[model samples]
Target chain A: MSLLQQLRLGFRSLMLHKLRSALAVLGILIGVTAVIWLVAMGEGVSYQAQQQIKDLGATSIIIRSIKPSEESSRDVGSRFGISYGLLRDDYERIVTNVPTISRAVPMREISREVRHREYAIDGQAIGCTPDYFGMNRLTIARGRAISEVDMKGYANVVVLAWEAARKLFPIEDPLGRAVQIGTEFYVVVGIAAERTAAAAIGGSLDARQYDRDVYIPLSTFRARIGDRVFTLRAGTTQLETVELTQITAVVEDMKEVDATADIIRSLLQRYHKSVDYAVVVPKELLEQAETMRAMFNVLLLLIAGISLLVGGIGIMNIMLATVTERTREIGIRRALGATKGEIVRQFLCETVVLAGTGGLLGVAFGFLCGPTVNGVRMAVGAFLPEVWSALPPNIRNLEPRLAPWSIIAAFAISVGVGILFGIYPARRAASMDPIEALRHE
Target chain B: MNELQPTVDREIVASIVGVSKVYKLGGHTVRALDNVSIDFRQGDFVAIMGSSGSGKSTLLNLLGCLDRPDSGQYILAGRDVAAMDDETLSRIRGRYLGFIFQSYNLIQQLSVVENIEVPLSYQRPPLPGGRERCLKLAELVGLSGRLGHRPTELSGGQQQRVAIARALVNNPHVILADEPTGNLDTATSHEIMDLLDALNRAGRTIVMVTHENDIAERARRIVRLRDGRIDTISEVRPALPVVSGSIALERL
Candidate 1:
């Protein structure tokens, strides 16, 4: 028979039992959709993490000081109780000595209660410089940030975190208004835009959250609040000395950070007795982020693979049942001068048709799932722009990536699965005794 | 008993020396055919007669190359068909053997014209004269009126007619009929018998295996088989003065 006629016959045979065919195709459909969606989700998450890490400045290196333990302090510099940790000279020395050092910004964080009239909020008070604005990706909502002149002249000005500003003064313009901090009132120079928290990349540093932070110049902080400071407690006359815990730096040339950090380490080694100094390169975090992405991809592929397997099983099931139903038909064809090869070809054609239809439908379902899922998320997100604003740069700009070769591959594999499952039944039909088949009801 | 199977050789035109077919059911073995043997030359018209279980169908299958005897040599047109392998048997059946069964085993999906093409398909190059051959066969079998009708769409008699045309398509040396009129009424049976008679007169060899004595009487020679053995073979002389058919004697 001609190929066209064979196809027509196959289609009609399938249509004869509509429910059975649909059930078979459904198995394939579910499997295919699962594969596409799971892979997409895993890829989406890993991609989001990578960009977040890259935004941390892939080329940048960070150096923070670590305090020495009691054991290390007992020998050498520790014998005289020469304190270990970030010395003021370490910062000044790197700036002056490192050849590739393009620009450097130092930051110190402290917790203080800022009060404006009746409202007060406890937040992190950060000591930073002019370059900190551009390095930390801080955008101004209103007013201006501390400039080079402000850091040089030790200006008593501060920048309010978006959430900090909202909590302390909900309806009022906090810009240019003075807020009390540790008995010293500072004017709000600018309001920083809120940014999404950095995802955990590796064991290097904790995630940086911009929600509850305040920025101030390092020079101004050193002048107003010296290194040796103490706070008094109620009823006990207890004193708490503020120890500088973290010094976040942004180097101008990202490539120089590792070598620069090593130099600073050796310089600090001569004067220090503690292991309290930890130099971190944000690029390491980027590497960890990529590793995570690779792991996620493998996981997604596994999930997709399971679904495809199920779909193949479904095709196998359907084809098996179909062979039984068409037993008599097959016998009749054989009797009517059709060879065993012809019979095989006819049934194989039927399976190809089933797979072709199911594969196309599955791909379409998978393609459409992204939009439908995203639409629901967007609908719910209407109530909160803050959450939507933190959406990763990749997903915020919607794009439906259609891998053409994958579509074709999926189509071909579906059909192949059908045929593989179809063999036993086709052979059964072909091997039947023609005389007995004629006598069969 | 000595006639268990026919003697087999390379040159015998058609031989059934001594063939015995036994069917085993549980511990009991029933003999379907009992030492039957017979011989006939090419282009000879012969009929087999017996009651149910008398092995008429078994004998017919042996003649048509559809089944092998338990013990017998069946030589057909100079070939030892009984000794041939299944593939050779199938090929031989395709090239030379033709069968007309009682049920008229025409495929329901195929039209009358397509049904006639079944045996012809087995031809190596598929003997040419595609449409013209189909038309001639249809006209020969009086199926010109319903060539396009499927088997179910046609009457039992009409379907049998298509089966006959299919049998004749390959232009084989021998034609085997197993109760070809078993399902047809008396008139239709007689009509089909007349058609067979006309073809036989035109030099086509026909073998009819039937229980009906009346059907046996139509043939030129009669062979009676019982207990898987041939009991008698008698030349039949017709009692009636025959009338000619309206259809012309056309060579396919």
Candidate 2:
């Protein structure tokens, strides 16, 4: 028979029992949609994670000073208020030795109570250079950030973080106002924008909360605080001295991040007797996140693949019943000069049509993933604001990115499933004895 | 029983020599047909008659090429079809034979014209003008008025007429009818038989299997079988003269 005729015949037969064919098609539709939806959601999640790592600066390396363990604190200077961790000399040595280092910012952070017209709140005072704001992705909401002149001339000026500005000033403007910090007064220059805090990543970096920080120039901090602070603890007066709590060095190119980090690590090891500093390459973390995203995609695909397998089994189940029900029809066709191969082709064509139609509908539905998720989010937010707010930021702002290859792959696999599950039933129909099949009631 | 003279002037369309078929049913082997030999000439209408378990159905199956003989040679239009593979046998059946079943085995989903077009669809070089040919065949079988009707909507007699139209659509060399009128009433049976008789008179080679002696008497020759063997092959009393040119026209 002509292929077109065979297909028409098969279609006509399937249409005779519309409910059965629809049920089979529904199985395949659910499978394909599940694959696409799950993969899209996974891609969205991984994309958010990678974006977070990229925001940490892919071409920058961070060196944080950690106090050495007691076992390694054998220096006799400890009794005389001798301090540990990275110092300003170490930061200068890095900028001088590493040719790939394009720029480096040194920061020292201390907690202090700030009072502006009786609005006293404990906040972090961060001493940094002009490049610190951009390197850490902090934006200025008002006025201007601390300038290079503020650092060079040791200007006693400060920029208040978003919440600090809100709490200290409330209805009044905080710009040009002097805020008292531990008996020292500094003028506020600018207000930083509100930023979401980043969670600690892989034990290399601590969680950073930017909303309550007070920014000051490193030169001002060195000239005023003097790196040595004495405090009364229990019954004894204890003194500690430390400088340059962290150094964030930016590389000229991403490819040099690892090599420069290695050079910095060896330089620190040569200078410091104790292992009190850690060099962290955010570039390496970005690559690790990429690998993890691939693994996540594979895991999602495997789950979707199982659903497809179940769908294939569903097709097989329905087809087997159909073959049984049409035994006499098969006999009639064979008697009507249809070859065994024609019989097989007829049944296989029906299944492929079922799966192909379902796959097409699934691809169409996959395109709706982004809007669907947004709609669901809106609904949830309207009905239960608390629940919506409780969701993680990654899920709250998820934008499903449909992979083109996944759409094609899901469709192709569904068609393959039709053929794979269709073989046995078609063979059963084809191999039937004409006389016996005709005799089947 | 062997005194009948074979018509030598007619061309032999099909013949089986020493054909036997054995069936195993529940561990008891049944010899359905044993050493049956017969020759069918072109343009001959023959009826095969037997009671229950008389090997008549088995003989019909073997002649229809639906089953193979355990040991024998079946030659059809000068080809040894007994040794042919399934694909080749299907092609032979499509090109050489047509079938009508007792149950009026028209596919219930198809219309009369679609059912008739089925056999023509399987033709390799696809019989041209299939719709026109189906319409013509429907007219020939007196079903032109109900060409679009499904089989379930038709009376038993009309369904059998559609089957007949379907059988003739392929323009096969031979028509095999298995108890063609078994499911109809006496009046409808006669109506179906009249159509068959008219087709036979138009020079179509027809082979019919029936249990009714009255039905067998309508054919020019009757072959009677009992217990897997042919009991008699005799000329039936002519109820009507062997008339030719029932419809005067060019043959397909």
Candidate 3:
């Protein structure tokens, strides 16, 4: 039989049993859709992570001094709370000597209970220069944060975070409010805007609570508060004193972060013997995010492959049944001098048609899946308004990143699956005893 | 159309030597053809006649190269069909031997003209003017006006006639017909039998398998099979002519 005639006849058979053919193709449709939709979602999540890391300043190197845990002999539950990590001279050396580094901002934070008449809130007292706000994206909502003038004179002004303002004075303006920190009192000079919570970039850093923070000049903290400040907890008997908690260094560009970090690591090698300091490069975090993205896609593909496997089995089953139903036809075609290869090709063509039809429909369905997911999320979000505050990443639906190559790959793989499973049934039909088949009632 | 070319010597159309066919069904061995040998010459109208289980069909299949015997050589035309590959055997069948199945085996999806054009599809370099060839074959089979009709639309005899045209489309050396008239009524059977006879008169070799005595009588020679063996070979007698009476003049 000619190939065209065989395909035409196969099409007729499929058309004759429209519902069965449709059901058979639905399996493949769902399989292909799953592959596209799941892979697209994985890509979307990975892309979002990379963007967030970029926003965190990809060139920035973070050096957090983890207070040594070996000081358990002196303290109870917490580590040593004092001047630890690399010396102050090392930060000066990094800024002056390393031409690779653009700027270095050293910071120290202390948690102290602050009171205002009846309302008292416990929050972190952040000690850093004015340049720290631009580096960490802390925008002032009411008044300006401490500038170079305040850092030079060592002033006693403070900035209240958004959460502190709402907690201390819910109905009054917090611009000129006075809050007492331990035995000292400082007037509120500014209110910071809300910032995104830092959820640890790959377990290298701790989860950050950006809401409860009060910014003060580092020079003022050193002169007035001194290095050994204490906080007596309500339940605990000991005091918590900390000089500096973190130091963020900004390198010139992406290429310099590695060399500057290497230089700083060697410099800090002699300062601290313990493994207390954690230096983080957002560049490395970005690379790790990309690797995680690839792994996620592979995992999704494997899950999608199961559906494809089921689709392949369905094709095999239908082809086998078709061979049985067309026994006499096979015999007649054989008698008419069709080669066994021709018979195999005829059956394979029929299977390929089923798979191709399914693949096309699946691509269409997968394209619409993005909108469908967003619609469902929006409907649920409407019922619960409190969840709106949790809607930065959730506000936008997962962008379906349709890689052109993925579509081609998916369709090609589906056809390959079809042919691979189709071969057995085709061979069975071709190998039938012509005489026996002809005599079949 | 010019009749089979008369060569210097007539070729042996088929030669079977010590051919045997055995079958195993439900673990019980059945000998379909046993220790049988036969020679068929070109231009010979041969009929294989036997009752059921006599292995007539088996012998027919072996001769057509559709089945290989267990322990014998089958040479059809000039090739050893028993040793030929399936692909080669199919090609040889398409080129050298035409087939007519008991069910007519006309592809129901095809028109009468397309049915006749099937065998011609496998012809080397293709037959020239396919439409013309198809129309001529259709006219020869008395289906010229019904060329556009599908097989289901044709009568049983007409369908068989179309099957006959399809078999000869490639101009094969022999036609192996497996009970071509089995599905037809008495009148239609005779019509098909007459068509086979006319092809035989045109010098095309034919081999038919049938148990009907009247049907077998139309062939020039008959080979009777019994118990998977050839029982006898007999010549068919021509019909006796009726005597003519003296003419009476009725003119005034």
Candidate 4:
């Protein structure tokens, strides 16, 4: 028989038990949909992580000074104070020694309360050079950033971050006004534009919020704030000294990021007594994110494949029952001169129809993944505000990215599952004795 | 009783020689057919009759190529079909034989015309004018008006007529009917037999198995089996003159 005729026959036969055939199709539909939906969600999460890493600049390497533990700190300190962190000399050495370094910005930050008049808010005071604004992609919205003249003369000038400007100068413009920071008054020169938080990369980098920082020239911070600061910890007054907190080095070429990072790591190892620093290359982090995305997709595929297998098993079960129930029809066709191969083709055609229909329907539903996720997010945010607030920023901001490959693979595998699971039942129906089948009640 | 031989002047379409079939039923071997032999000529109508387990059904099954004999040669259309493989045997059956069942064995899902076209679907090289041929056969069996009706919608006699139409759609060398009127009332039985009689008169070859003597009398010859052996071969009517120069005769 022609394939078309066989398919028509198969469809007609399946229509005899409509509910049974529909249930079988539903099994495959669920499996295919699961494959597509899970892969989309996984891709969205990994995409978010990779984008954050890319925002950090692929050619930049961040070196942060970490405080040593108490045991390691005791040996490096004198009775005056314990100082175990990057010094001003390390910054100079890295800039002069690394040939691939295009530009390096040294920064030191301390948490303190800043006030203008009676209004006060806790904020970070960042001490850095003029290049720090350009390297960090921070733009100025009002007035101007700290200039080269301000750094050369150790001028008492500051730039307010977006949120800091809004809080300290709530109703009035704070430009040319002085804000007091720990008994020192610094004039505001500029206000940085608004910026979103950057996601944490692995365990080395913490999630950064840029809204509450107050910027000043490195020379001014060293001369005014000084290196020594006293703090009461556990009812004891302790003194700590630190010069520079971080150095961000930008490589001229992306290919030299890893080699330059290695050179800087060895140079620092020779100078520091203990491991009190971390070198983070955004380029390396981007590569790791790519690898993680691949592994996540593979894991999703494995889980989807199991569900498809279960769906295939359901198809086989239904088909076996159909073969048994239609034994007499098989006999009739055989008696009318149908070959064994023809019988097999007929049954196999029915299964392909079942699986193919489910696959198509599943693909249609997969396209709804993005809208469904957004709808659920909105519903939770509206009805259960506390629970929605409790969700991590990643989940709250997630956008399911439907991968085209997942759609195609899911459809092809569903049909393949049909063929793979269909063979045995088709063969069973074909091998029955014609006389016995005809005589079957 | 002596077995009658085929007339030498007529062309033989099928013949079985020294055929025997044995079956194992619950570990006990039952001889379904024992050393049976017969010849069927073109345009001939023959009926096989016997009591239950008398081997009439077994003989029909062997003739239909549904079962292979334990020992013997059964030739059809000049081929030794008994030795043929399953695939070749199926091809032979599609090319040379048609079947009508007692229960009107029409596929429930198919309409009358579609059921009639079932045999043609199995023909190798595929028969042409598929729907047109089914329509013509339905008209021949007086079921043209019920072409779109399923078997369940038809009466017993109408269903049997549909089966008869299906048997002729392939235009085989022999048409095998297993108790064609077995499930019909007497009036409906006569109606179905009348359709068969007309087809037989139109130069078609038919082989029927029935337990009713009256039903057997409709054919030209009746062969009775007893205890797995042929008991008698009787002629109820003389063979009609074949319409020579007809398309069927020309093909043969």
Q: Give the per-residue lDDT digits (tens) of candidate 3, residues A220-257.
A: 87776766655556865453444556678898778888
Cα lDDT tens digits, model 4, A198-272, are 657425344577888999999999999987768889999878888888899999998899999999999999999
Displacement of residue A271 (Cα, Å) in model 4 is 1.2
**Model 4 vs. true fold: TM:** 0.92
Estimate TM-scores for all models.
Answer: 0.68, 0.86, 0.75, 0.92
What ranges in model 1 sit over 4 Å off?
A: A2-4, A57-150, A155-198, A201-318, A378-410, B1-101, B104-155, B158-179, B187-209, B213-224, B227-252
Q: Give the best candidate by lDDT.
A: 4
After superposition, which runs of candidate 2 have C-alpha atoms over 4 Å from their true positions? A1-12, A66-85, A109-125, A133-145, A158-214, A223-242, A270-277, B1-9, B26-28, B237-252
- Compared with the true structure, the alpha-carbon lDDT of candidate 1 equals 0.70
Model 3, residue B109: what's the lDDT? 62
Ten contiguous residues minimizing lDDT sum, candidate 2 chain B: B241-250
Best by TM-score: 4
Mark the regions of model 3 whose C-alpha exceeds 4 Å error after superposition. A1-6, A57-59, A65-90, A93-102, A107-246, A250-277, A383-397, B1-44, B70-73, B107-155, B201-203, B237-252
Give the worst 10-residue stretch by lDDT in candidate 1 chain B.
B239-248
Residue pairs in clash, model 3: none
Model 3 chain A: lowest-lDDT 10 consecutive positions: A73-82
Model 3: lDDT of residue A330: 82
Q: Which ten residues in a row have the lowest lDDT in candidate 2 chain A?
A: A198-207
Considering TM-score, which of the candidate structures 2 and 4 is the better prediction for this target? 4
